[model samples]
Target: MTGRPGGAGTDIGLISLDEAGARAAARVAPVPGVLELPLVEADGRVLAEAVVARVDLPPFANSAVDGYAVRFADLRPGAETRLPVLGRTAAGDPVGTLGRGAWRIFTGAPVPDGADTVVMQEDVTLSGDEVILPSQSRLGANLRRAGEDVARGQEVLPAGRRLRPRDLGLLAALGLERVRVRHRPRVALFSTGDELTEPGRPLKPAAIYDANRAMLRALLARAGADVVDLGILRDEPTDLERHLREAAGACDLIVTSGGVSVGDADHVKAALSACGSLDLWRVAIKPGKPIAIGEAAGTPFIGLPGNPVAVFVGFVFVAWPLLARLAGATAEAPVVFPAKAGFHHRKKAGRREFLRVTLERRDDGAVIARKHPGEGAASLASLAQSDGLVVLAEELEQLEEGSTVPFLPYAGLLG
Candidate 1:
């Protein structure tokens, strides 16, 4: 990979992926705000404050079945006790007070005072407003206690938590009409290349349709970012500089692909340096070695590789976590699973490798990974057809078949 021209405060040295990520994360600050939004609009937003329970869930003890509430001491394992049915208590109906004889209750109805157990209607025989309790009745049977799901004053959702659909449902169940959440990070994305053409247009012999922009936009949206498509820029430094300036003023972060390489048409690196400080460039990784991290007019700019697969890998390893941090989201380590290598692979030391593979269930019910045929960074079909990527550490030289390796699933990342 080529290096960036030396400038004030620019680290042009080659660094490992971990070092590159750490440096990039340290350069940006989290966006500040605690906006109060309705629960309906809070889905996919990170919580700025911890949500504490205001009232006990199921505030009162209720019956979990449509049955009669009774005292456990009134019946034994073998003996039958007859109790007169007082008033029927359906859901939302008031059961004034329970008489010593009995009380009728339906599902979700509050258990009557002085009742300690519930017996399903099918377990007893009813005759003329009188029911015989089975001797096998147990105490607290079919009864849901107050605060079983949540307690008043308990923290239900912590800060930095990304709210999911089920999380919003839980908040609604708690009667929370509104919640405080971190502001979404505005991301402006663009592409740059003379040989690139937009989809749905006729492609010349030397030009190919742009795929990195769409792919990265989808990935950013999936990460809960407010994406602004800035379209494509030519191989001119002045044109790239204009877009960089606009993006810097309008967005919290700027991401672009296809202009950070060593070719003469690759003017994004120079444009960024001319606009602001280019902090780091060129990470030591396969398929994505030509990465760039810079700040243009105080806005963080990430220049990803031109290849489609490389752009995706770079986003997963670098941009995703940085965007989460900028959006005030809690960071989580990538999910990895142990898989046995189905083929022998060789790699150089001191550089992480992400090998694409398809996972299949073997006859013994074990997951066996099969490596894809093409390993080129521009092969989007291979990445789409594969299930996950196997991560090889920087130290190992050779990996034989049956060797245990860590694999990361693409489905998990998107989710």
Candidate 2:
């Protein structure tokens, strides 16, 4: 297979996944519009600007435990000292100035004036308003200094960062009621295959349920895109062309699975050619070789494979980055970790392969990866049974048992 047919104005050819990704990212712009949302509803939203500290965290120096605040000089080793109880202070309560030879404090309560240290109540004996400090107590052992947790005017969060539940709590601690976040990218999804059927309906002999549409929608939502389902289309050039035009006009990006193959019934290519331009069609990757990329009505269009696993891989390897770039995200390659191979594996030399494998913890605390039983791109169960993908570089054809190989954990991206 090759990339989509080039337009009359420009020449297009098959490119690697990296080059295609760069071109797609360069062609697409970030989603427009920003909205101020309450911190309570801001989870999973990317920040449009940096979050600075409105006030110091903790706000004031308070007691870390229920104890008495006193002058360190009053408690010396082997020296007996008795200080008068200068009243009491509880959380959110104020205690007047600490007179000489007296102490006052409590848990979470502000330290009284002129007191520099706190001694736990368990370490001292109290008898009728008089407190006796142990001779071995250290000076200033339990004081929580003001501005220790967060300083005033500090930049707590930077722009372009996605907010999590914990991040919202941090903003709450800083007393921010609202935040500014980037607009979510609008993604339009559709599928093409006369043999495809929805799950609820009974299937005919040559029909299969359209799983790629649902799967890609979930993945795109996880990547922070506002997905609009364009449903499935028949294998007709006119119908496919109409949907492609509508999707392009309605959404920032258009994604579809199937109908980009070389077979005669595959009308997606012709439809794209009729509408606008299809720039790329194929990539140098296994399982997802028949990928299609182009622009229709100035909206980016990504065509994935028909196989379930291939659709997902293509989404992760292609569509996900495109969506992230459109959402104003600073895209970075996923991190890979080294693991030992539990079994030998073989592949071709020119095409990159992502083998599904289950990683087991060995006795030595190292991870050993074993390939799944079935390697077909249509086997969705194989992905469910595996932990991650063991990437084989284009030049490598064989890997021996116990050889160290780089792998990417599915947990990193999906979780």
Candidate 3:
């Protein structure tokens, strides 16, 4: 191991939160393989190539409302002009040329060749076969021009962007059936601890059910990684080293929770050192402090804390960006909004802290972040019940009530 990572009192080689993120991102590169999938299967996949528009959006000018299509010159400036309905057109009907009278056009119908304006049907009264036109209808109103939304040959979606539902709709609108997307990064995941047992089984004395694997599995799926579950590992250095060696050859990245701290039971750092190399970083952040980032037999590895909340925070701040980069996704930080603090908190200097908080909109139209009462590192309920995290910077010694704080919502972090 490069350097030892400890829990408390030992602060030798502790890096900042930003530095930890940068080191993790620098350890892995994007997967080179690409695959072509139909538009229906492309959701949540990163684009390997930019999507160019094959044709102009709404290739033809269409009516924006159910109304009359007429030449702007036909309407009198200060008086109502009556025109006989010459023809009718609905959506998908071939467009026709506008004559002396107005053409009754429905919404989304192609505008007639000689018409420059459309008046809403509700704005004019119909008498016999003629429609009364209002005097003040503006020119080019209620019409969608060709290529208004997107032009042909334009890049609608850039490479490295994760495809969403709306992005799929845009691709379908451009008449594309298949899209080239980067191959999903395969991640080998596991948890280590002698006092852990799987759920659905009776727990022995001094043992707890394994929660990290299940939670991390779901989070990995949400982040677009194809997870290779190695299951729960016992705290044996030989077995751990063997598993890491096998996983390294098959997976693009290997992730484990627990067994990185400087304790008798922690053997991940030593096992990694035996097989390949290890960089044990003590990050200056609350909940998650000692994080192990290294390689196992040449494959990248990340060892997170065993505490559920710490694992969650560590994955979001440290591992998530590395996974995104490996999956060919562009870097996107979670958006944080300013909110008033409904409670007060005090912390030490030289460490960043994240408080689980729920937001409340006060009667005065101000958003307030109320911190969760459970402040333990392993409190899973705090993560479940709260909206997101209220970030307290290292320089902030005390957060007073009613002070402005930066709040990051969980909605912005997940898929």
- Top TM-score: which candidate number? 3
Candidate with the greatest lDDT versus the true structure: 3
Q: Write the per-residue lDDT of candidate 2 for residues 67-181, one digit (tens) a residue.
A: 7888776666687678889778888986456776556577888888778788888888888889988787776678887777878898988887778898999999989999999
lDDT over C-alpha atoms for residue 358 of model 1: 96
Candidate 1 structure, TM-score to reference: 0.91
Tell me which of candidates 1 and 3 scores higher on lDDT.
Answer: 3
List the RMSD of every prediction in angstroms: 5.1, 5.5, 3.9
- How well is each residue in 366-398 modelled by candidate 3, as lDDT tens digits? 999999998999999999999999888766676
Candidate 1, residue 101: how far the Cα is off, in Å: 4.1
Error of 1 at 156 (Å): 0.7
Cα deviation of 7, candidate 3, in Å:
20
Q: Ten-residue segment with the worst summed lDDT in candidate 1?
A: 1-10
